[model samples]
Target: MNHGETAYGLWSLVALNSTVFILFAFSFFKPATARDWRSFGAFSAFIVALFVEMYGFPLTIYLMSGWLATRFPGLDLLTHDSGHLWSTLLGETGDPHFGVLHIASYVFLGYGFYLLSSAWHVLYHAQRQHSLATTGPYARVRHPQYLAFVLILLGFLLQWPTLLTLLMFPVLLVMYRRLAITEEKNMHKQFGETYDAYAQSIPRFIPRLGKARLTADAEPKK
Candidate 1:
C-alpha cells in the first residue's frame, strides 16, 4: 500500500470537519433549554465520532481489516475512497463521492439543515410570543428539529458508515423521541385544550400529506 494514499492520522482534518458541522448545526438549531442542549450535545458527539474515524483514525476499518481483506483482497482499506464502505460493499466502481449513496447523503444533509433552520425560525418566534409553534415546519411535525437531527445523522451514516455512529443512531432516535414526548406533556399542561387540539390534528413526526390544519394563531398574518 502506498503510504501517500493512506488517509488516516489527519487530526487537523478531523477537528476542522467536526467544528464546521457542529457550528453549522448550532447556528440553525440554537439550543435554548436543557433538553435542547442534551439533544444537541448527543448530535455533536455523533459528528465528532464520525469525523474522528474519517480522518484521525479508521478504527472501524482497523477492526474489520481481517474480514475486509478476506472479502475484497484488492481493496486498499487505508485509502480515503475505501472509507465509503457502502460504495465498496455495493461494488460501485470509480469515485465513491459520486456514487448513489453519497449523492443521497447530500440530499439528506441539505434537507436536514433546511428543516433545522426553518424549525428554529418558527420555534423562536413562538417562544417570543409565549405560544405553541404550529406554523411553518411545525405545522408538518411537532418535532421538526428532532427530525432534522435524525436526517443529518442518517446523511452522515450514508456518506460514511462507522461502527460507533451506526450504534449511536438508534440510541439517539430513542432519546429524541423521549424528549419530544416529555415536551408534549409540558405543552399539554401549559396550553391544555389548545395543545390537545393541535396534537390531535397534527401528527408528531411523520407529517400528513396535503393541507395542514392550522389554528388561528398559526395562520399567517395578513
Candidate 2:
C-alpha cells in the first residue's frame, strides 16, 4: 500500500478491531464485582487507546516523525508498516508482522487470552461451589487472570510501542497487584487456612519452575 493507503484516518478499522478485542475479553472475563469491572475497564481503555493510535491516528509516529526521519532516513513514516516500531528500531526488514517481536506478540496474546478463559472457568466453578480455586491455571499461579492481563498488555507493547500505552502499562501492573492483594485478603477471610496453605504453596503471579504439587483435590495439610 502507498503512503496514502497507510496509517491514520482509518476509523472503521480502529473501531472494528477495538470492538472485537474488547468483546472477546468481556466474554472471557465476565466481570461481576466492582474490582472486576475496574480491571476490565482499564484494560478496555488501553485497547481503545492502542487502536486509536494504530488506526484512527498515528499520534506517536507523528510526534516522532522528525527524529525518526533523521535517524532512519528515507523511511516512509506514513506507512502502517513503519508503525511497527520494534521491527524498525531493531533494523529488521520485510513484513513487520512476521518479525520476531511480532510473532512473539501473537504468542503472548494467544496465551494471554487462553489463560483468561481458563482462569475464569475455574474461578466460576469454584465460586459456584464456594470453594477455593486451585484447579487449572490457579493451580500454578494465585492470580492467573491478573497475570493474563499483564501478558496481553505486554503483547501489545511488543506489537506497537505507543507513548500512551507504554505509560499505562506500569500503572496497570500496580493496579492489578493491589487488586490481587485485596482479593487474597478476602479469600483468606473466607477460606481461612485453605487459602493460606494454597497461597504458601503457589506464587502470587509467577509459577514455580517445577510442576505444582497442589491440585483441586489435594487437601491442605494442617
Candidate 3:
C-alpha cells in the first residue's frame, strides 16, 4: 500500500484496535470490584478516544491543519505520516515510525504492559488468599496497576499526541491518584499494620533508585 495515502475513516480499524487492546487489558486486570471497573472504564475510554482519532478521524490534525500547513508548507496534511505530530514538530525527515520517539514509545508500551500483567498475577493470588500483595512490581511501588496505566498512557502520548488525549492524560493521572488513595485507605483498614509497613517501604508511583531487590521470602508475608 502507498505509505503516503490518507487512511482515515476506517472505523473498522478503530473498533478492532480498541477491542484488542481493551480485551488484552481486561484479561490481565480481571477487575472484580466497582473501583477496579471504574479505573478500567476510564482507561478504556482513553484507549477508544485515542484509536478514534488515530484511525477513524483526525480531529487533532484538522484542528492544527492551518498552523501545520503554514509552518510546514510542503507537508501533505492528508498523508498518514502527517498525523505523527512529534516528528513533524521536531523537524525529523525519515519515516515517523522509525523515529527515536516511536522506538522509545514501543519500549514504554512493552514494559508497561508487562508490568501490568505481572502485577495482576501477584494481586490475583493475593486477593484469592485474602492477603496483601507485596511481590513482583508491588514490591517496587505501592500502586503498580496505576503506575502501569500511566506508563501506557505516556507511551501513547510519545507516539501520537492528540489534543484530546493530551488533555485527558493529566485528568486520568489525577483520577488514578485519587483511586490509589482510596485503595490504600481500604487496604489499611483490611490489613492494618501489614499494609502500613508495605506503604512505608514502597513509594506510591515511582520506585526508589538503586534499592536492593527483595526476594519473595524476604517480602512481608500475608
Candidate 4:
C-alpha cells in the first residue's frame, strides 16, 4: 500500500470506526446544548479527518507528498506506515501504530472520556436538584467534562498531528474558555455566594494539590 496513493476504505470500516469513536465520546459527553453540540461537532470533524487519513483517504500524505518526499527520500510513501507522521518526523522506526506514544495516546483518550462521563454524571445530578456538583471528579476541578474533551483532543494530536486540526484546536480552546466563563456566570447567579466560595476554593480545569488541596465541598465531605 503506497502511503500517498489511493486506498479503498470499505463503507463498513467507515461506519464502524466512526460509530466506535463517536459513541465512546458521546457516552462520556452526553451533550445537552447547542454549544455543546457545536463543540462535539468540531471534535467529530477532527476525528473523521483523522480516520479518513488512517483508513479511507490519506489526504495529508497526498498533500504533503512533495515536501515529505524531499525530506525523507528513503520513505516508500506507499506503505501505510508512512502515514504515521509522528514516527516519520521523529525518525522512530518499527511499528509506529503500536509505539509507546501511540499506546499512551489511547490511554489519555480513554481516561479523558471516562473523566468526562463521570464528571457529567455528578454534574447532571447536581443541576437537577439545583445543588453544586462537589463529588467524585467534580470535587477536584470545576469543569472536568470540558477538561476531559481537551485531553481527548490532546491525545489525538499527540498520536496524529494534522494541519487542519492543529488550527482548529486553539480556536476551540478559546471557545471552550468562553463557554466555561458563561457557565460559571450562570452558576454564580444561581448559587450565589456558595458558588463564589467554591470557585475560590477549587480550580476551574486544573486541580491544585500540596497547598491547593481543598477540604471538599460543604455538602459532600471528601
TM-score of each: 0.95, 0.95, 0.94, 0.87
Model 4 is weakest, by summed lDDT over 10 consecutive residues, at: 213-222
Rate residue 162 of model 4 by lDDT.
72
Q: Which pairs of residues have clashing backbones in candidate 4? A: 1-78, 2-78, 3-77, 3-78
Compose the digit string of candidate 4's lDDT tens values, residues 1-222: 334643335556766787898888887677788978887887788777777666776767778989998999878865667767888999888989888788888998988988988998898888787788877887788888889988988898878777777787898798788888988998889877778877887889888875444443444432
Model 2, residue pairs in steric clash:
none
Which consecutive 10 residues in model 1 have the weakest lDDT in total? 213-222
- Count clashing residue pairs per candidate: 0, 0, 0, 4
Flag regions of model 3 displaced more than 4 Å. 1-4, 212-219
Each model's lDDT = 0.91, 0.91, 0.89, 0.79
TM-score of 3: 0.94
Per-residue lDDT of candidate 1, residues 67-179 (tens digit): 99999987889899999999988988999999999999999999999999999999889888888888888888889999999999999999999999999999999999999
Q: Is candidate 2 or candidate 4 better by lDDT?
A: 2
Better of 2 and 3 by TM-score: 2
lDDT of 2 at 135: 78
lDDT of 3 by residue, 81-178 (tens): 88889999999998999999999999989999999999999998988898888878888888888898899999999999999999999999999999
